[model samples]
Every structure is written in structure tokens, then in C-alpha cells.
Target: MMRGGSNVSDAQLQQILSDVPRIINDPKTADVLVKRAEELGQKLVTERLRMAQARDIFDELRQIESIWLREPERALRRLHLLRPKLAYRRARVRELGPLAEVLERAVAEVVSAGDAAQRHDRFRRLMEFMEAIVAYHKFYGGGD
Candidate 1:
């Protein structure tokens, strides 16, 4: 049975149980920024899917690169905080784990690899992962 006060009505509260680190590390104020982050994350996901369907690797990479490069630390920080939380839920962890790895790899490759095409491919894949991460943040209303 659900207990009063112990129950959080928002679906995001369920996500918060896992995303403790994200809650701790979020720069956005708990009141104002978290909701905004969540919305932004959710919105980017549809954009990513549309780009993927169109086979628009260049466009996807361009968008992701802008976000990642402009805020590498923030991206990294978000991932760092999210990975462990997601890992706790085996099924969801399985679904999202590879994406996390892909994003991490893409960041590394983009930062280190000199080959233009390879970097572009990595960045494109990274977009998929970023979208998912953003979706997660969206689900949480930012930090949860």
C-alpha cells in the first residue's frame, strides 16, 4: 500500500530513486533548472529520431557536437552522475548501458581522433546516446 507523504505523485520520482548522483550534482537549482533540463532533454530526443530516420548523420553530428563541445564538462558531468543510477536497474541499465559507452567513446574519439570521417561517425552515434540521456533527464524533470 502507498503511504501518504512518502508517495510522490510525479512519475519522475520513480526515476529519482535511481538518479541520486544526478540530484546531488545538478547545477540547475532544484526549483527552476531541473524542470527545464528535463523538458530540454525530452525535446531533443524527437529531433534525434527525426535526424536518424532521415539518415542525416551530418546534421546529427553538427547538433551533438555543438552541445558537447560547448558544454563538454556538463555533458560529462551529466553522464557521470547518470551511469551509476541507471546501472541499478538491470533491464534499463542493459538498454542504456551501450548508449552510454557509445557516447563516452564518441567523446573520446572526437577529442582524440584526427580522421574527419571517423570523428563524424562517432559524433553521430554520440547524438543517439545524448538524446537518450536527455530523455532520462527529461523523465526526471532535470535532476530528479
Candidate 2:
């Protein structure tokens, strides 16, 4: 389970558990991100993803990037903070469903990467994933 993400109900937990194997070996992380990022962006469009929510998460990502440049270890801690927020926001704003799902996956990727070097690589993937999602979201006329 992700740190501070204990709020997942039994149903959601079951769904995620079932997704684990597919998520684990469906291709390398970078390749999967490349293939699915656009689809996720489009999914957000279908979900009517809110601009304010996207902006807030994006801004937090930027902050995490800056912290990463300065303190690599601390950056990981900061990244972990997103788990709880994703859970909370997903509950409060239904439109955040797709966005929260993708973000949660990214965080899980980073958390399970196993070591500092691996985590760094996963973090880069996470960043790239979000950038692609946001770009495609805007391209798809996703608006507030």
C-alpha cells in the first residue's frame, strides 16, 4: 500500500490488486508511458477533468522537480505526499478520477523502484508522463 493512502475502500483495493500483475509487466515503464499518456489525457477529457485540479497538481509537480534538483532524498519524500492528496481529491471531485488514477500509478512506480538510482529513473518517467498528459489534455480542448 502507498504511504498515507490507506483510505482506499475494499472495492478499490481489489480493483488495484487485480491490476497489479498487468501493471507490473505490460512493457517497460517508459514505453508504457509513451503509449498510454495520450490515451490518459483523452480519458481525462472524457472525465471532464477540471483545470484547477490539473493546475494544482502540475504546480506541485513543479515544486517537486525544483526540490529534486536541490535535494534528491528529500524529493522522494515530497513525491510520496501526493498519494494522500490524490485519494482525497479523487473523493471530493469526481472529475479527478482519471487524473488521480494516472498520478497514483506514477507514484506507485516511483515508490516501488527499489533504490535511489532506480527511483530517479522512475521519477523521470513520472515527470514525462505528466507533461505528455497535460499537453494532450490541452490539445484535446480540455478546459475548466
Candidate 3:
């Protein structure tokens, strides 16, 4: 009494239906499902770790913005605009070698500046370098 377009035989379908409960109760199946669940849980943990690292980077960027920009609203706005790119950068930091070098140089320049004008200029360059890092991260995947 199988319907048209059905590939399964009636006896096969009946056997499968009859085996369903036994399959569900099988210890081997339960072990496989538990292993899969553990794998998924590990993936979730790894993802959370990446997100946390990204958040920490964003926090550092916010601090830099506040120190250099001085305007709360403007700093907040800029951080909001750059948040996604920053997240991407944090996740792929290892891949962004040149960008990381640029950032380090810019930070060094900012730290070494002796006067207000020089500090401001260096900070501006640092911000630009950071933006470049995010851009690079967006286009390229992380390193090994």
C-alpha cells in the first residue's frame, strides 16, 4: 500500500518504524550524540574566547579614543563605527603582520612625542594604523 514516488518498500518502512524505539534507546547512539554535543560545546567555548579577546581589544581602542579625542560623544561614535572591524581584527590578529607592525610603530611614535602637537599628530597616525589593521583583518583570514 506504498504511495506513488515512494522508494521505500512497505516492509522496509515497517521495519524502520519498528526499530525506531530500539535505536533511540541504544547506548551506542547515546554515546555518539554525547560526543557530538561535547564537540559543539568546545566550539562554543572557543567562540566565546575569541569574542572576549575582541571585546578586550575594543576596550583598549575605546581608551585610546578617549585619551586622544577627549570628546565623549565623538569617541563613542567612532568606537561604534569601528566596532565590527575591530572585532574582526582581534580575531585575526596573527594574520595582520604588517598592520601590526604599523600599529606598533604608531604607538611608539605616540609614546615618544615630546610636545602636544607632535603627540596629536602621532595619535592620529596611530588611529589610522589601527583602522588599517581592521581593514586587513576584514579582507584576510587569520594566520596559523
Candidate 4:
């Protein structure tokens, strides 16, 4: 049986957040990323987190990633803004539950990634992780 916290018993998702950089560095990382996300997706489904809730959060993250940055500070400001937006979203969509918990960890990682270069890398990995999560969430039958 699945074991760990209600969100993800062992904080596997949290590990995935912190491991993004190392995972990106590994020569054999690509499939590892997908495999990990797929496992998390199954857990998400088993926990009954809904697809819409996950997608809505992803949309906000995507918007942040897609913005053009003439000044790097603008991107950081946006990232800072996302934290509260996520909090408001989680409060509104209680069904988000563990998924929000997981996303929050990722946001924390991105915000504290230490420097501009590292932050950008972490952000991309965060996007990849969430994209895989959303795709696998749909693949595993998560729905409204």
C-alpha cells in the first residue's frame, strides 16, 4: 500500500522538487524524471486529487514561465507573487489538497534556488515536473 504523509507519505514529491537540479545533471535523467512523475501521478490519482485543480495551478505557473523578461527582477517579482496566488487558490479549491502541498514545495524551491542561473534552471525543471504530473494525472484517469 502507499505509505507516507497524507500528501505523499515520504515526501517523495518534495524530494522530486529538490532533486530537480541533480536530476537534470544526471546523464540518465530524462526517463527518471518521467518515471518519477508517473509514480507521483498515480499517487495523486489514488489520493483523488482532481485534474481541473491541478490544471488550474499549472496554468498560473505556465503564465509565469512564459512572460518575457527585460529585467530579471520582474521574473522574481512574479515568482514571489505566485506564492500568495497559490495560497488563495488552495483556499478556494480545497480539493487541491496534497497537490497544492506538493506545488508549494516546488515554489519554495524555485524562490530559494540561490541565484539567477540556478533559479531559472529550477523553474524549468519545475515546469517539466508539473507538466509530467498533469499529463500523467490525465493518463491515470484523473477527471473533474
Candidate 5:
């Protein structure tokens, strides 16, 4: 979740926003960057399915809790350790460098529109495009 109040950083937000499109356009890059992020995602789904099947055979919430719920400390430590890895991922993406200036010109045209509704629609479409990037990144590892 995004942080609330004035502490929010524009750099971070822009990074997030900037990422939306590239991720959609590339999935292999994401996979390579994220240490089997795609494989892990599939593994997660498979584990969930296995748990559901196990639930049918055994009604033991306590067992499930023991297996999954006790890992918060480990998860936190992993997050800390993974921070550098994630940073490298972001850096690698940036190394590919800036979007073509033409895209910026297109955006400027939308931004310059006098109609607020038109501007809103333009931004919304941009967001959708970005979301596709995210989805692509999350799964296919930047095929392009």
C-alpha cells in the first residue's frame, strides 16, 4: 500500500508510475530481474491449490497456520535481504533508459488539453497501459 500524508516521495511514485508501461512491454526482463518471480507466482498458486485439496481431506486450520502463519519474522528478514535484489532489478530496468521523447510529446498534447474530462481520459488510458506493463512483468518476464 502507498504511504499516506506528506511523507510520500514523488521520486518513488514516479518510479512506480514509470514502471507501469515497461513492465507490460517486457516480461523476460522482469523474470530475470526478480529471481524467478514468475515461477514463484506459479508455485504460490499451486501451493494454494494443494492447500485447498488438503483442506478437503483434513480440516486442520492449526496445521495450516503452523505451516504458513509462523513465518512473519522470516518474511521480514527475507524482505530486508531482498531489498538489494529488488533495487538491482529497478536499476537494471532503468539502465535500458528513458522512453522515446515522442511518447512525452504525446503526453504533453494530452496534458495541454483545455478540457478536464479529456485530460482525465488520457491519463486513464495511460494508467491502463501502465497496468498492462505491471501484469506483464508479474507473469511473462518481459517477453520483448
Candidate 6:
């Protein structure tokens, strides 16, 4: 049973699974499916972050920063993956000027730090950058 009181029976679930090949064969439907999957992934990440304690968030952010420090290109690619969701959230919360400013600055710092040669400095900047993101989500509910 799902939150809306709709129960997905096994037969329906099996039917959907049986249609997988057809779904993949149709380009338009496949594209829609992929987009929906991405949105779901973003929602899951947001919910996890929202439910996490500050210490847990900090630890995860540090791990991400460490990855960035060690392999900047990979980190940049990972950050790029997050761009769409971050942009959406920013647009939704544009009225929060100060928070938006901080987020913008942090994003810029992260991008710039990717090119920086000093690992220690880059790590610190990356931590600050992620902290800003965490702060935004904490203060304001993650945007729809």
C-alpha cells in the first residue's frame, strides 16, 4: 500500500514488469521513464539529506570533498549531475535572496576549487560549499 491509499497488487506489478521490453523499445516512453527515474533519484537524495542529522550530513559532505580533493575531474562530473536539482531548488526559492547568495557563492567556490592546485585549500572550500547546500536544505524545505 502506498501513501495515497492505492495498493499495487502483484498482478499489476507483474504486468508492468512484463511490459519492460516494450517500454524500452519506445523512444518517447523510454525518455519519459528515464526522466522520471532521475526525478525519483533526486527526491530520494533530498529526503535522505533532510532526515539526516547534522553530523551525518557533515560526514557525507566531508567524504564528497575528499573525493573532490583526490580526483577533481570525477568530482566535477558528480557535481554536474547535481546541477539540475540545485538549479530547480534555487529557482523555487528565489525569494530567499540571502540564502540564494550563499548557495551561489558556494557553487562558484566548488567550481573554482576544482581547478585549484592546492589540495588542502580546495578541500576546505569544498567543505564550505557543501555546508552551504546542507544549510539551505535545512533552513528551507527542499523545493518541490
lDDT of 5: 0.33
Candidate 4, residues 44-136, lDDT tens digits: the string is 777787887788778887777877245566777877887787788778766565567666766777778668877777778778878998887
Tens-digit lDDT string for candidate 6 (1-144): 122222334354344434333333333454433332233223333444332433343564466566875787676665554445455655654433223333343444445443355433544543543454454444334433
- Tell me the deviation in Å of residue 46 in model 5: 27
lDDT of 5 by residue, 32-99 (tens): 32322222223323222232322221222223223333563342343233334434433544421122
| Span of ten consecutive residues with least summed lDDT in model 4 | 1-10
What C-alpha lDDT, on a 0 to 100 scale, does residue 107 get in candidate 1? 49
> Each candidate: RMSD to true structure?
15.7, 8.3, 22.9, 4.6, 19.0, 15.7
Better of 2 and 5 by lDDT: 2
lDDT of 1 at 46: 28
lDDT of each: 0.39, 0.69, 0.40, 0.71, 0.33, 0.42
**Candidate maximizing TM-score:** 2
* Clash totals in order: 1, 0, 0, 2, 8, 0
TM-score of each: 0.28, 0.76, 0.37, 0.74, 0.29, 0.36
Task: Give the alpha carbon lDDT tens digit for every residue of 36-128 in model 1.
Answer: 334334433322323232223224444446766567555445434443443443244343333333233334544443554544444444454
In terms of lDDT, the poorest run of 10 residues in model 1 is: 1-10
Q: Rank the candidates by TM-score, best first.
A: 2, 4, 3, 6, 5, 1
Model 4 residue 23 lDDT?
A: 47
Q: Which structure is stronger by lDDT: 1 or 5?
A: 1
Q: Itemize residue pairs with steric clashes in candidate 4.
A: 4-9, 5-9
State the lDDT of candidate 3 residue by residue for 65-111, as single tens digits: 76554664454444344445544664576523222222333344454
Question: What is the clash tally of candidate 1?
Answer: 1
Where is model 6 poorest over a 10-residue stretch in terms of lDDT?
A: 1-10
Top lDDT prediction, candidate number: 4
